[model samples]
Target chain A: MTTSAIAEALRLHPGPVDLASIETDAAPGFDGKKADGQTALADLGSELSDLQERLWAERTAGSERRVLVVLQGMDTSGKGGVLRHTIGLVDPQGVRITSFKAPTDEERAHDFLWRIEKGLPPAGYIGVFDRSHYEDVLIARVRGFAEPDEIERRYGAINEFEARLVDEGVSIIKCMLHISADEQKARLAERLANPDKHWKYNPCDIDERAFWPAYREAYETALERTSTQIAPWHVVPSDKKWFRNLAVGQLLLDTLRGLDLQWPAADFDVEAETARLIGEAPVQ
Target chain B: MTTSAIAEALRLHPGPVDLASIETDAAPGFDGKKADGQTALADLGSELSDLQERLWAERTAGSERRVLVVLQGMDTSGKGGVLRHTIGLVDPQGVRITSFKAPTDEERAHDFLWRIEKGLPPAGYIGVFDRSHYEDVLIARVRGFAEPDEIERRYGAINEFEARLVDEGVSIIKCMLHISADEQKARLAERLANPDKHWKYNPCDIDERAFWPAYREAYETALERTSTQIAPWHVVPSDKKWFRNLAVGQLLLDTLRGLDLQWPAADFDVEAETARLIGEAPVQ
Candidate 1:
């Protein structure tokens, strides 16, 4: 498609993300691009497929490495797309994806990470948390999931928590899927339109929407304070999903390249122990 | 790096597979051009991480779409890498990874798909089976997961089972991870020599080593009888893990892309139904 046609297609698509910013500018607060409509869906699908195979190898190899991909975004900011694109790439076993909603009664009683930690993948595994412990800092503060002082203290705790994970050999990559106000309303409205999809919508979303500025403040504070050298945050422009997905895909490739893991020394042997790990698990 | 060095590095770093001989080659084939050894640990590790991302995407998206990935392979043929790759790329919530071995008495009872289907991912999820129902046709014909005549019946039943899934909108991708006897022996020996790794060494694996040809025959027969249009079989090159990972990643990407699932479209009056779907489940 021609550039103008692509721009028009993007206009049909909701959200106003400028992806070029992801690749080039990170400073002036991501001047997001418009979606290329037809191209966005077509390309995201292809890239997702290619990435899937690489991730499967890591799962099968059962190497002593772990990858944690955390996505923190505002409502209707393309967290679902980020998830869809992220899974669009890999095999099912080594990659574990979680979308966090309201905490279970049990979850509320325990330390924030208590429920979150159970979901962390083992070595050579990748875990994606749609909304992770950062919720304790963001939603908890905005929705009163925790006390103000508690929310304030969790920032350091969040940093320490992530630092511990990185130190323990888990590669942590955090993404804040950023979208515009108009985009959020459009998405929330879209969810309100379909029947089969009706299952995904919740009225509480409106309540959350009312506190957008509060959430923004909570998010900004959570992000700035918890964002550390160990786990840097990427505020992805979700208005243009194609760009967001491409950006995420690129980031994954870059980080994977940087990790540089290998099959355990050929002579060192991995089969038995790896097999044993599976064997010892209560065989279903 | 020199051509040889590059070749050595490529050997260890898993990438695209040569599809033509994927059915025949066994081993996580190295791409690194190392004259002294196979792919380096660093390259392989990085490759695994990349593979993991791809696989994670597929797991999450495919699962949401209710896709099942079936991986079958001989000893030391690198099924593990497939697992690693597969899991690494999926959302863990939607990705269910299962490895089938000797069935327990309870599993032996009831139809094969009973246990197998239990492992089936919920609608809108991804399921990965390391060894699957085909065992009724494969090993049952060989070591007998069922009666001799039952094995004959199962081959057809297996075809229908997969066919039914496809008919019901389930996407099935079956792969036979092929490895060479030589590579298998080397890996087997490596596991045996390492004290820590000894636990992974299975005496049963050696017992099957003697019947490699028979197992091959069973695989061929099973493939011919059961490889339906809906769930076509891909014999991946086991030796070249890079290629295997690449091939699988591509295949998964292509598979999910083929489904073309749109985010369930927005539902305007979903609050009531959303509550019901979750409410139907018993609280723990």
Candidate 2:
């Protein structure tokens, strides 16, 4: 399949989704050759950087546009790797990475999206939320953090919030890094086995893992209810780490490419400015 | 003098600043050779773009640093041109431009800095404000829009506001686009002479021109009272537009260069991911 078709396949349709129907280990656009896939990923990375530079430039010279990438995944699903390997390929200054931990005291004082509002990438930026407001629906739902009615309200709130950002020149890319429960178990085991990764191991993560079935249900509801046309959710088959990185990277490239970005034309007389600068003293 | 030294010379010292002591027409670094100065300006533009890209990149991989360029000037002192020529060189996605006009009724309802706070640049962005919070003191003071006591409160409020932003990782570059009264009159006349430029001319601008001395006094006070070490004001001579662009461009380059930015090292095993990708099937 073409990479764009593969990217399109990753997005979840706007309705109830049976997570079982999507294969977590599938690498849809690959040719079963790692070297070629790696090479293709690298080429896409360069193209992504070039497009990002123009998008960044377009904010001042052309229409000021912005992008936000929201990644929601179960623990140990390689969210960090996707960020470092895929999104990390671009210039760091152009990307805003917000790994939303538990809400701070100040953040808890306001509406959930108040902090999200603060986190929205300004015009021309590509913002990444390591774990985003979906937590309000996911963990918040699975753990009974908010009432069902309140959780229902959040779906509408999230849809409206995303629509508002889209209205204000932000393009949202939402992805769920889908990995099988068996794969997650093995990954957790590896993290524990490697002494170097002991620091990354959280006891609460294992406890959270116990509720995997419930968490999957929560994700299904959140995805189905909140996937609007403006900001749809893409359920990326992420059991194979490399495929996950390539898919997310391709998704980002395509999103930025879709922006009608142009390097702004000079509004003044460049010839006159050139002549005048050379003729005059460097003014202070 | 070297271009850097000339750029440094434009910065106004924090204290009692007498506007007459500063020459608005002197081109400090130019050698009466438009070609060489233009070449140097072009070089600065490229350097600025490189540094800004790294700075934008650094936000995720490195320190997540950000810069704000605040331009304050008299009518026709070339703030827009500086934004277009000097700042225009960087990728627009990396730059956020906020041109502050007269506050709307809703804006007037809030504390002055409330609006300013809303416009602060996010990490990794180079934000430009054509006319900024300084307007509160400049036009407000000249027009008696605020009581003397309230204006006194604002001086302290602005200093605190700037200090808070610096603390939050934003480096502010404030410039007063300094042009002489005669230059202003000539620019206004030229605006009228060209029918194409008529849309940019406001009758209120001509009326405000009548209070030039009051405006100068107001500026001198604003510069002296609010030029914090964290956000000092640079008074760029604007009689020559080319020099103004070059000076501001050089200043931005120097500022971003000072940021200790580096590309982020990957936190995951690259070799393993590469191996896994090459070996996996193109799972559909």
Candidate 3:
């Protein structure tokens, strides 16, 4: 069967994602023209809305199907921007967004995936995780938040958890918003330069930036270990904010359309009901 | 403060909503021209999209504000269409939609508002209820599903519940999508005539149609008892589907625009960060 060109170009096939081999500035689906790319994004936005409506209807009619978009990016990689500009194009009514910050004392008490399981989107809904369980492996590994043995066990736990979610009808689109150290510096600098952007600036972000090399190594390890056949990780280049948005949007649109969703069919009689309704006296 | 013209025209003020006084086919927010009205609806759709983003950003920045849209109407009154076309214009990532079906055994075990409280949109989100707790008063009363005394207490409970939500920063927009019996008949007939719409056809809907007068009386009683300063009811004339969509869209836009939301300001230093980023070596 013929598939969407954009999905075919961007999808990371089953295997390891070599972070160094991926370009952070690639716009494979767009012409060089900015306006043309934006127009394409707009068009895809409307299609995503339509497909989402059908998906909701399918679920309402008793179909247990769902889409979960896992966004993992370093600080200042524009996860919030993607949430606002790209996926934000679909209706908010049908989407469930979870922004996982540091686990609370109560949350930390449970097993790592405990908080995550509570936030999964129900069948027929689109769920977005601004930061997700992968944080367990990424930040925990890089920050020495967990022991080396515990980190290894988490990798195994995550794989088992995701495989079960897939078995239960969740279609996962995991995108690591990949940006270079230089790009990160520019973004953080921009945040400091603009007073309006200061609210997003945390002094600790600089502390994390100091560990750039270590974090990159941590990400490369995590991607290689977790990119499975059921839920492969797409390393989205984040140097060009616009391209990152477009690629992720197209990835989602393709995944939803691939479901071949249909507007649910009616279950009751038409002709007799029509005749009865027309023949009946006005309720007024 | 001046309110929006469309909002002013469509809002049902403090009084018992006499459904008979409302015109199910009225399009007060549109010009007489259908094409013009459709164009106007499209414009409002985009505006809703922009405002919704800002509202979400406001919430993400720690504003505890929210909007809840309650849609209560007879079957075939176009609740699903509103969800798909009007509200669907906003990004799904920020929306929380709940379509209340009959009470499941577990739900029946709890108070009526138990399920509703679980579905509310958090700060900065817009929550849409296709059908809501008012059913406890409407269907339960008309179909004798609950005792008259129990139904009466629910009205007081609903008023208190809504008042608390408002006090906690949830703005409520309750709308009764009013369609004439003839309009409903035609819609049901159209559903039957189209094979693709078959799944939406529920024979029980026709059985409920037989008790039209009781349902109307029940709705009037519910509206009169629940309409308060904090949560007013807007009886929308929904015989014309396009008009219905436009009216709801306009109401939401006006409500959100009235908030006078501001983009959050940055908290970190700009000049220093810019200098540091520009001076930094490439991590590649």
Candidate 4:
């Protein structure tokens, strides 16, 4: 079967996005850019752009409703590209994106939730958590930030936290940006191979590979435990970066469209301003 | 003399919510509610929700504008809180926030702008740079990320980068979250006093103290050279967390309100759906 067909079947079935299944058999390396490929991407971007505009409006009018997106993935899973593409499509004012870094002394001082809560999005706004509170349960769980009970407590806390936010009108959209192990290794190797990309890697990241199973368990546990009615998980296939971007872009656009945003009635003299600015519709 | 006075001035100045001056001393201690004393945090949260909604609609409408918020300050300054509160007021769908961590091997590989550009918010979105491209110039100038020419080159790149973002409809809002040196000690001491907080303290944080003077010089240079018409720095006095939250909240509210967001015309079926779900509005 073609990669897309295989991807579709996996998505339709209730299973994880298998890291081993991605086929990376293409003959290596680049020219500049493929004309058709670039055009296809451009076309997709334009189509997504139209939807993004509408979504932006819905976000404003549905001001009562907001979207919270949680992106989780192995390193080099196109999180940045997904973020970049998302940015390319929407109005920056309505959007807020966060890439969680190592906890600060201040952040460590408080419970993880304290820092995460501090970043909660207001109504009618879109907030993206590049790595989210899930870290507390995922990394912290394996790293031993707390005991099993504590981890269990946080899993419940996460659900309740998201539920409350949703009930209060926040739409929590969780995405597991999935990429294959080989794919990740390839990406990591690229970073190592290219001096320019070296800054993105950390020796610690390689060290963390030893604990991949532990982290996978942690992620699975958190995902299983926290995936609830308020915020369901979309294990987005990320083997193909372009398709991943398109899928997410479409999802966001669809959600925003569903919001039914509208401008409020003018509190000021709109007729005067329109006439002044556009100078009388030319008697049309 | 008081930070509140600046806040008062920001309020009095014509615009959206008053862009108040926030002295650290005037910031509210953790009272467990809205940092702005007049409004319960719950209320502010609700208000933020409203603002978020409107801003989002405007964003999705193809305005394709972006907002850059820069927060700089002394250690233990209110930068984290500002980040938290700002994100607190918006939806998470269209935003990404990145706090510059110690350069990773991969990151150190590329030019400074490489990682930074990776974090910039997309179109019609808001990206909050906790510590941003400023680091190349700030830390390089202070900690020496590169040689002198590199630092100087970064400044030009910064100006150009920001200009590019602005030219592409990015509206930059920069703030220096100011805190007193004494406050830093008090906070540090507080952390030290608590055993639970011990892990939070990195000896490196104190090590940075040795370079405080150097860091200050770097910051001054950054402010002088990099702060421009497109991205002027707002020096916020964050001695008081509440006042800081209040002032910044006003700043954001004011900025967004000026954007004049409105919902699109409601669709014909919106009422039908509303009635289908909420059983129609009361007679009115």
Q: Which residue window of length 10 is worst by lDDT in model 2 chain B?
A: B275-284
List the candidate 1 regions with Cα displacement exceeding 4 Å.
Answer: A1-63, A90-93, A190-200, A262-264, A268-284, B1-95, B100-120, B133-208, B213-284
Ranking by lDDT: 3, 2, 1, 4
Second chain TM-score, each model: 0.73, 0.94, 0.96, 0.77
Each prediction's DockQ against the real complex: 0.11, 0.04, 0.47, 0.02
Highest TM-score against the true fold, candidate: 3
How well does model 1 score by local distance difference test? 0.61
Supply candidate 4's per-residue lDDT for B24: 44
Candidate 2 CAPRI-style tier: incorrect
lDDT for position B23 in model 2: 85
* Candidate 2 stretches greater than 4 Å from native: A1-284, B1-3, B62-64
TM-score of each: 0.55, 0.54, 0.90, 0.46
- Cα lDDT for residue A136, model 2? 94
**lDDT of candidate 1 over B29-128, digit per residue (tens):** 3343433122333234343333333344333334334678788888777777766554454444556788788788998777887898788866665678
Model 1: TM-score, first chain: 0.74
Chain B TM-score against the true chain B, candidate 1: 0.73
| Candidate 2 chain A weakest lDDT stretch, 10 residues | A275-284
Docking quality (DockQ) of candidate 2: 0.04
Two-way lDDT contest, 2 vs 4, winner: 2
Candidate 3 lDDT, B130-230, residue by residue in tens? 89999999999998989999999999999999999999989899989999988887777777777766666777767778899899999999988888877
Candidate number of the best lDDT: 3
